[model samples]
Target chain A: MAELFISISIWPWLAYTLAGLVQVTLIVTLVAVGALVFIWLERKVSGRIQDRLGPTRVGGRFGWLQTLADGLKLLTKEDLMPEGADEFLFRIAPYVSFCASLTAFLAIPFAGGSYPFVALHMNTAVFFVLAVLGLEVFGVILAGYSSASKWSLFGAMREAAQVVSYEVPLGMCAVVPVLLAGSMDLVVIGDRQTGTFWNWYLFHDPFTFITFWVYFTCATASVNRAPFDLAEAESELVAGFHTEYSGLRWSFFFMAEYGSMLAVSLLASILFLGGWNGPIPVASLLGLTFENGFWLGFAGNVLGTANLIGKGVAGVTVMMWVRWTLPRLRIDQVITTCLKYCVPIAASMFVGATLWQYAFPNGAIFPQSAAAYQVREPWNAKAEAKSAEAARVEKTASREPVATEFTSGRTAEAAPLSARTPDPAG
Target chain B: MEAPIYWPTFFFLLFSAIACAFAVAVVVTPNIVRMAFYLVLSLAATAGLFFLAGADFVGAMQLMIYVGGTLVLLVFGVMLTSQDRFISMKTSGFELGVAVTLGVCLFVVLAYCARSIPEWHGMKAKQVSAVPLEPTAAPLGMGLLGARVDGPDRSGYLLVFEIISVHLLVVLVGAAYLARARGKKNLLVE
Candidate 1:
């Protein structure tokens, strides 16, 4: 580790590489930290809603250290296994949940303009995030089923049904923004919304305006938040899926829950709201050009990072308030709400957005659309034209033309191999 | 999109171990709930295999629909049917003996075919080329939308995509219908 750090210190490429690793480590840390904050926040929110003071002693004012204390206590407790439980499945389930939750962070872009700020930068990031998020239910199911308790099994069943039912509308709502952006890339979606608050897709078109609410409802359900948290409905299920789980294992599930809540919120900010894009175009106005402006871009990125985190925190706070203020829905009611209401609404909004995008291809419904926020350096028309010329040369040199593997062999690039393969003409 | 063989080799080995072990446990475990649990693990690991083979869509589909959806439904079925923790339906020792012998024979034949195939074993020590990792969303989205706008133009996988969409809708309806309790009879009648 020391030698590796030394090399990173010496070489600029190594510094960049180290920076990339730090970005990933930082996201994981943020999720861990966010989980701590949200759990505390949940308690406080629930407390105020229920007419009580929650966690006032730990870490001064707001009980900021309360989560850490709870975590330590959980760690010290005995790891229990119930009779008739599948040992391997029981042991592995929580890790699976945590893994799925953390993996979704890979595709989320915290800042719009920069290198290594984003974890995955997948072209299909929105889909990828949604897809991975769906996997978290398996762990919950496993935990409940393997617990050998009726309560646990019941909780798992409710969650399974809820997640599956909600995914239809959740997917529909997610696609509305994708349609408006003309790309599935989350960064592009965020950048497209980079001028004023009104530029956010929530105000883009009438359909998008409506789509935001549908998305929020579906997202809340997807994360098993209030009005839809029938999965872990404590009053009904007697502690639900984790009824048999004590100590560290139980905490893992909550951490996973908080992590997912934050993830969905971050996704919301990126898709419906302006992600890292603040209400003002500060970075662009300050002249953070791509070339010969690395430090300025870096500083802008740091500011955006702070902004994104602030937005994410604000979203989690809103969700907490909703959870506390609203009553939990029955499992049937939860599924009914998602399918009967959220699904149809999201579908209608999607169709409306598609028509709107079709009609107004480049029409700026808000100021952000024309804010001149940073675009990706490569993949522009000039570069596209150059690559087109290169393709022409390749076409003449071959009897049967190939798919033109120009950037494919170049290996390390921000974009995926699939992106470069598609001819402009096609 | 050649994954460094390190990934596939490690993944294939892990997948084979988990899948084989879980499959064996499924047969050996007396309790029905235990069998169901083993089956979920086995299928979940197979989803990982799908991911390793670069079928991200299929992997997610398996997780979201099969393991996450179907398996959860199956677990519910097991819970609903079971009156006891270990719900064992016994098969005779003679039946087990015969099945094991036959299974071993089939495995040998399968292993021979897999090991002997030139294409399968051709890249014994091949350098895993890093796949130019772009966001597969657009092409995948386009492919699903009946457009062959990217990749090796074999006219897109829109048919498969649409087929799955219809299939999932049907599956949801059929499974709900099948799993629903009749007014006169319980759903899990066993």
Candidate 2:
């Protein structure tokens, strides 16, 4: 795209900048539009779960424009500032949260192929995404401190403790997929789970199956959803860190929250749920691949993008389901769940998965697709093969002298160093 | 035709400017919490500089461990102890002078050492642009696991990694012991 613009006489830098802006605009649109839809979905889901009609009067019978109405209301509302609040930090907090959450999308590939749909093609994308997501907590902490309210301070402190504790188990569970894929690159991890539903890391083994649930539990807590959302605990802390925020500023926190929810769900899908590849492999079955033609490849990429988004949305819907189904956990219970249960379970599963991989390099019960197994680094395999051949030669060499006799028949003994050395004068 | 912009250099200048400016902001800021925030920005910009230098793994590590983990704790501590009395400190003139002198001396040493690299001094733009930014995580992971993928086979950092792990374990145990409650015996009876 940059090259096309440059060819049309635009300056090279400007062309590149334009290309970047296009990608950024697309991602921003996804986040904003996704937020609009998700807020409506959340209401609809919550209402359906409670056996009631939700937002029936807004934009039709289904209230399709309910979120838009809410957004407009939020925009026009008076922006309030508490007398004691730190003006600067109070103002910047929501943006900080939103930006950190949005930055994480840069490394998340929405489609997997030679040309992946991602803003930044990072090798350590998993690490990068996780790191950036962690920064979102800073905004909450700043908001809480700046609010000068007891509830906000308490909310922030709980958030700090909860997030810090949850990250340990979360990272452990995440590493299981990385270990299985043998790469931190999200594309590689996703590509490793191509072909069939059974090929997904969630179904890789007993350990991975268990690891998936643990990962989801940790993910839910990490994202500060209901049941583990001690930070907000609406009944207790009022509105939590954003209690003092009003108007669009307050809405930014919700946008950040929903954006991160999508981000982590997408990450989970990529890590454990086969990513852009569907359960049925419809695209591949229809001969839609880069090998066929550019159009076919483009079609495959489109299918992949839809597959990934569907999986992400499904993951979010499941999170909403869990939120509505379960009673909220106490703060102590949340911490205990992370430290005592999730940490130990994730650790054991990690160890078990490692052992399973060692026992079955080509997979155990369910056979992996040939392409998946072959994606292991060729250099590493080559080095091992080379070492094995060298060992075989050494073993045969040691036995060859014993099996056959030479014409001279001198005993096989070490030659003196001086005798073996060639004369320098010669 | 206009000369093409060198993006890496442009980003390098942008990151360095933010990093240096924020580092100074951290020292000059009166509020402790604001100082912590400035420090976070400064360290994050330094991480950006690391990325520009083609050290992606180190840059991510810098963001995760330093800016995310350590600074979060620093800010938490500041928030916990955030009385107005502790928010700002008034430094004495003599102490400021002494600190500036020490800072300047350290800066001079660092500058001298950086300038001592002859290859860095003579490197041309073409030479700089020719180097590809290959992902170092795989090789770094291999090296940590006792394989020298980037060079001739030799001793790698596996032993060092083990030693550090054990050292960290000891520190964790020590911390746990120190932080344990004192009056915890016969809790059921109590």
Candidate 3:
């Protein structure tokens, strides 16, 4: 898009900056709208689970505008800070958390392939998302410490411990799909699972099936949802790290939490469930893949975006249901689950999955059962073969007496290896 | 036509400035918690530099391990030990002066050495533009698995990798031992 703008009369810098701004704006709007909808959904889900009416009168039936109303109320409320609080840390904590959550989305592809859907097309997007997601703990810890309240401090401590420990298993579980797919690129990972529902990584093998559950559990803990939300146990810590925050500042923390929950759910869908790809290959069957014309490809991507969003919403709704249904764990129990149970289970599954992949490289669980989907040969195979052929030629060239002709540094032999290697894409 | 403003260099400068400024802030800050926060900013900016330099894997590793993991641990330590009196410990004037002098000396020497390298000065725009920004994750993985496929000479890091794994295990056990609860008398004495 920037290149298109640059091809016109626009300045290159201006075009690039504008393109970035547009992407950032889109992602920010997505998070804001996602948070609003999820909040309403959570309230309705929780209310139903608890045998009570959620909200019905706010904006017509079902209180569709309840979150908006709440946002206005929060905006109007007075901002409060404790007398003994660290002023600087107290003010910046929420933004730090929110920024971390927002940044993680930069690497996440809403729809697969090299397109304008992702804000930043990172190669190691899985690791990048995991890294940025972990940074959210800093904001919680800072908020807890700067609150100058014992409850807040305790909550922050638990949150830090729980999030840090849970990251191990969460990362391990995520790596299962990365192992199944050759590349760490989330797009490739998602693309590999295309074709059918059975082709999803969740059904790739017994280990991966188990891994999906473990990943969900760890992801739930990592995002600090219920059953593992020792960080904000109301009965114990009042409101945990955000106890001292009020009004807009308080809402930012909630936004960060909901954003991360959605992000992880989206990640899970991409990793285990066929991301963007539905149970059935609707778009592909309709002949709307990228191989089709530009308009059809765009339509396919639109459909994919909807599919991914739907899966993410379903995942969040399930989280809300679990939050209302189960009791929160104690701090010790949380630690125990992470260390004793999750870590070991994830480790065994990782090993098992690796072995399973080794034994059944074609993803066949049973000899009689056909593989769900044919694995796409890696995109770089031809490039690698070409490079090897070039290397062999270069070796032969170097061995000949003509190699001395390159000593003056003006011959083709003096060119760097990079110059010799052909780019398949180019 | 006049060459367009190099955006990569612009971003590199921006990230480097943030990183250096925050690093100085970390050193200057008296409060341990604030120092930790500044350190996080510094390290994060450094990670941005890594990304700008096209070392995405290393950059992500730095963010995850250094900024996220280690700094979180540091903040946890600061919080645990942060009593009102202990929150802001004043450095002695002599110590501060000496540290600044040494730091400046080291900076000058390092900067001089960096500038002394001929090839490091700058790359031709043509050469820079010719380089591909391909993903380094596959080569990095292969290198760790003891196959250096990126380079013509295919040496690997399997030995170093194994040694690091064993070292991490030892550190984990040692840390657990060090943090283990002792009797009340021993705790009071410590």
Query: Stretches of candidate 2 above 4 Å error?
Result: A1-9, A373-426, B1-3, B84-86, B180-190
- On TM-score, the candidate that comes out on top is 3
CA lDDT scores, all candidates in order: 0.75, 0.83, 0.83
lDDT of 1 by residue, B1-190 (tens): 9743354576699997998899899989887766776887788788778767666666656766676667666766776677675467889999999999999999999999899977876344434454443334444554565443343334545556757899989997998898676875554653
Give candidate 1's root-mean-square deviation (CA, Å): 7.5
Candidate 3 similarity to native, TM-score: 0.90
Give me the runs in candidate 1 sitting further than 4 Å from their true place: A1-24, A49-53, A83-88, A114-116, A367-426, B1-52, B119-137, B144-146, B149-176, B184-190
What is the per-residue lDDT of model 3 for residues A1-426, given as tens digits with 9 covering 90 to 100? 677678887877898888888889988998999999999999999999999999999999999999999999999999999999989999999999999999999988878744536777777899999999999999999899888898999999998888889999999998999887766778878887777788888888899999999999999999999998998999999999999999999999999999999999999999999898899989889988767777787788889989998999999999998999999888899999999999999999999998987676665853312322222222233333445653444344432212211221122223343343333357
Stretches of candidate 3 exceeding 4 Å from the true structure? A7-9, A114-116, A366-426, B1-3, B184-190
Q: What lDDT score goes with residue A413 in model 3?
A: 24
True contacts kept of each: 0.23, 0.26, 0.46
> TM-scores, in order shown?
0.80, 0.89, 0.90
Among the numbered candidates, top DockQ falls to 3
Give the alpha carbon lDDT tens digit for every residue of A1-426 in model 1.
224466756654465567668866887799889888888888998899899999999999989899999999989999999977878778888988998899889889888754526766666678778877987887888888778788988898888778878888989989888766656677878877877788788888888888888888888889888878888888999888889999998888888999998999999999987988787867767876354477888788788888888888888888889988888877778878877888888888888888776676554564334433322222232334556664454344222111222232112232433453434356
Candidate 3 per-residue lDDT over residues B79-174, each given as its tens digit: 767668228989999999999999999999999999999989889888998997677776676467564445544456666677789999999999
Q: Return the clash pairs for model 1, or none.
A: A123-B135, A415-B134, A416-B133, A416-B134, A417-B132, A417-B134, B4-B128
